[model samples]
Target chain A: MRAGAAGLAVWPRWRPVHDNGELKSGETTMAYSEKVVDHYNNPRNVGTLDKNSAEVGTGLVGAPECGDVMRLQIRVNAETQVIEEAKFKTFGCGSAIASSSLATEWIQGRTIDDALSIKNTDIVKELSLPPVKIHCSVLAEDAIRAAIGDWRKKNGAE
Target chain B: MAKRVESAVAAACPGCAAAQEGRALFCAQCGRIQPPPGCDYFTVFGLRPHLNLDAAALEREFHGLSRRLHPDRFIRAGAQEKEWSLADTALVNDAYRTLKDPLRRTEYVLKLSGTWGGPGKEKTPADLLEEVFELNMEVDEARAAKQAGKDERAQRTGLEAARARVAEMVEGLDRELRAQWPAWDAGAEDTRRSAERAMALLVERRRYLSNLVREVDEILGE
Candidate 1:
């Protein structure tokens, strides 16, 4: 009985918790950020934009020399400054895909200023990305800012 | 197998009455020599005979062709046809790999246009010769210093400094190429000779930078 009691004491008291109405697992897992991995495995907004649209902002960044090419587009309402839609097509590795996806998700329904304010570091933190993949998020964030800047320039808004 | 033979004969020698059987070198009726299988890289890819090209467009075209002509898609073909397919695919991959990188592309273009020979085999540009000579001398001095077991720190520092200089030169040449690209694309026929001259300079610059980078990489073991 004493040996069994000692064994029980040594064993970690594993208990699932309710944190902010969501269940939290006690065990450590090596699984990647589910949202980022999902987007990487199955990418969204993978296509070109309609250049004819006046309300669209198109930003093409990255070089093949760098082994990455990304194109980001945002459709915004002229007066409201709200992002109606966001899309991206990237030719890069899994990190790039996840970055693009995260950027798309962050920008939808947000104002141009809000979208531009979203930093690469924030994306990195949210996705729990490693150091090597931080640049992918930076590129995505740069694309978002570039697209917004283009939109504002087109509309003659400072 | 028989079907493939018929198709190959028809494809290679259209409208020939006498279709030679089983890899014959000559036509039975006309006695004319048959051309070799597989087209040249330029002909097959439909690219102009130039060193400079749009890399993005080349990649897109390569992927499109690969989807259709890859050997994996020709598994049902007989031995000879499969062999041709594999060889052709390999050639395509090689061409794309060589053409994608700017320095290799320049060297290949020079060779194709009958201007430059192999590595360290061409005349150095007059303006660059002195600097190139100086850099080579510096590299040799550093190597000698390391061999003598004296001033190892200084030798290593000199090597790193030389590598940095080469990296800066590479960046400058890359910038020049980027600046010249749009103008080259939009230039008038009368300005084409000047554009070609500018392109030749860029190509030479790329060659110099590539050699420098290779030397640095070898020393650094990178």
Candidate 2:
């Protein structure tokens, strides 16, 4: 169990296991990642960084014309390539916020390689997010990967 | 052709009681000129002229109405009705787009109220008025100086500076609006007064930016 995993305990009880081994309860259960939703419903690490010391990576993505803007930040250990912190600010709907939150939660403490491998589908499946809202999670996942990619590129960590 | 059938349906002109068939320009019974086969933006969305609207509510309504009235759902209708539906849906889309964006929202709100293109509808705000006047004067001076064959460098420099200032102001206003939005959406009852005040400022700032952009365009002969 992680710092935030306790919140998910509520889901397994209410969720009915199905033939596909997926959880189904209601529309609320259908559209959001439980972790993402929890973070959106209660966001963590919601702020900025000391760009000088933090080996920071920031990603600003999404189109407000399509009606969502998300900013993702990651702080990584320069030598170890471990993600030390993650934060986000999003101008979007619930699913977008949840996706960002879920991504941040998943990335903290993981090595850059591990973080990179965590797919958008993993986040979607973890939270059971619906198709329409999957893009939101994908965007967050992309932002994280982008920030890491940027960090690696800058530091010659290819 | 499908277009011909659509034109024939439109020839009936739904608003008028007249039954005009092929080759008729005016209604035989009412003599009203046949209107194009589409609804106007306002009537299509079923909204009256209004400025202060809940945007989220409006979006919900638009999506809900679209589910019922969009032409995609009307493909089975005969050519005429389908054409009319498509045209009407396009109008609805245009209306939603215009009303959704803050700058366009302000312009359309004024236009719908018959306040556009009139003298003394309300003077632009004092701060905006000063900027507008200053920018206009600078442009005029530049043009005059150019025509009189004075040093063009000074005028060119002045024009660039003026354009940069307007751009910076627009960017600053956008930042202010974005910064204020989350606080406004938090739904604190006590914050309502402050939110309304902020919204007023945002609206005014948007108007000022629009005017400034137009003035700059005029100066550049765009």
Query: Which candidate gets the maximum lDDT versus the true structure?
Result: 1
Candidate 2 clash pair list: A33-A127, A34-A127
Candidate 1: Cα lDDT at B218: 57
Model 1: how far residue B118 lies from native, Å? 7.4
Docking class of 1: incorrect
Docking model 2 quality class: incorrect
Model 1, A1-158: lDDT tens digits are 01122111111111121211112444333245676666665566554467458798976554211224456889999989999899876645456667887798789899998898999999898888766466678779878987888788888885
- lDDT value for model 2: 0.56
Off by over 4 Å in 1: A1-158, B1-56, B106-122
Cα-based lDDT at residue A30, candidate 2: 46
Kindly list the interface RMSD, in angstroms, of each predicted candidate in the order they appear: 24.6, 21.4
* Candidate 2 deviant stretches above 4 angstroms: A1-36, B1-222
Question: Which residue pairs show collisions in model 1?
Answer: none
Report the first chain's TM-score for all candidates: 0.74, 0.72
DockQ of each: 0.01, 0.01
TM-score of each: 0.43, 0.39
